[model samples]
Target: MQKKMIKKIRKRDTKGLDYVINNYSKKVYYLVDKIIGFYGREEVEECVSDVFYELWENIDQFDEKRGEFSSFIYMKTKYKALDYKRRLEKKEVHKTELEDDITNKITTEHIVLDKESSEEIIEIINNFKEPDKTYFYNRYFMYYKVDDIAVMYKTTRASVENRLYRCRLKIKEMLEGRK
Candidate 1:
């Protein structure tokens, strides 16, 4: 069935493309969800459509001697999802840098913690465990939102918020103990 569809697609038959989409959209959606579930449904759907577009555009690249049609589509979906993820990451990085610049300007004018206290806080953050340290650095030092951190770690926003809360409590206790 798939091979016939692939052949027809290679022949520029639109029906074959429709048939492939009808038969394989669910599997493609599942793969996209697994790779980029942190994104909204609209974005995931867009990625699915992009996968089909890629398959349509590169139909000639499919070689029967190399592998099955399903494998080809699966690889295409994975790569497209990864590409989307990379694009989002780059956008987030640029946005973060710009926001940090503006924020630092405002914060430097208002905030006045002593250098010793700032050093102590940095030391405390450095001692945190794997993802807690990463979460703290991303949230406080890098100024990322909880949603972005959740997406970056492929976890829920609530989980990121809870962990950050716990880390903050620990830092508070450590600081209070010093005083």
Candidate 2:
């Protein structure tokens, strides 16, 4: 089945693309979702479509002797998903900085917190343990979601969430004691 589709794709028959997408959309989607679940549904759908586009464009590179077409598609989907995630991260960082600058300029008269409290909060965050500190910085400072952190740490989303919850409670207790 894949050989026939490959042949058609090599011949530039559009139906070959259709056949591959129809047959493997779910698998591609699964890979994309696993890699970039922090992205919205539309973004994930766009990534899946980008995977198909990649496969279509690189049809000639698909050597049957190297491996299966399914494997090639899976690899391409994973790479594309990671690439998309990196691009989003870079863009988000710039966007956040720009927004912060604008907000600071607009709110000069309405500072959200005094300098001392902000410094204390930073100290608290810096004092957190290894992976927990990293997780907290990624989730709060860098604005990463639980799913993104899970992928980064190679752990489950539930585990990340539970750890974050416990960390938050601990921080709350510490802050309450300080007051």
Candidate 3:
């Protein structure tokens, strides 16, 4: 039955898709839920649906030489669920970043005079060398608390502040055409 279904689906038969989904959706849903159940029922349902769609799209990658077709489907479902889990984790981190009051205050109070300069300055800081870039961000962008950064980097609090200050000052001078 599995071989017949795979053959029909491989031939682009829609009923074969229905057969596979009917037979396999339970296993797929169980795996997705187990991996990312914390994302809530709605996301779990959506992940199950996406897994089926991916199984259909990637049917050609199945290799009889390697393993059974059901194993292939389950593996794909596992990877898709893991991918969803990673994306959700990143969303939480970004949400935390946005909720940082100091970051918001710095973002508002220091706009670099205009949108274009703001973009350019951001570009410049992103390209700054090594720990300087990280230090600049520790002080300004990420709200790392200078004391905490000094401890983490194994440096004096004043040293952290001064390096960060020089980085900021370079951007300031460049923006003012003083460089």
Q: Sort the predicted structures by lDDT, highest score first.
A: 1, 3, 2
Clashing pairs in 3: none
In order, the Cα lDDT scores of the candidates are 0.84, 0.80, 0.82
| lDDT by residue for model 3 (120-155), tens | 887879888978999887766677777789899998
Query: Model 3: which ten-residue window has the lowest total lDDT?
Result: 100-109
lDDT of 3 at 46: 95
RMSD over all Cα atoms, model 2: 10.2
Q: Which portions of model 1 show Cα errors greater than 4 Å? A: 107-179
Instruction: List, residue by residue over 31-145, the lDDT tens digit for candidate 2.
Output: 8988887867887999999999888889998888999889999999999999999988888887875685455334421321423366656677688887888887787668686
Q: Which scores higher on lDDT, 2 or 3?
A: 3
Q: Which pairs clash (backbone N, Cα, C closer than 3 Å) in model 2?
A: none
lDDT of 1 by residue, 4-108 (tens): 888889898999999989989999999999887786788799999999999999999889999988899999999999999888788888798578546653543
Winner on lDDT (1 vs 3): 1
Poorly placed runs, candidate 3 (over 4 Å): 102-179
Model 1: lDDT equals 0.84
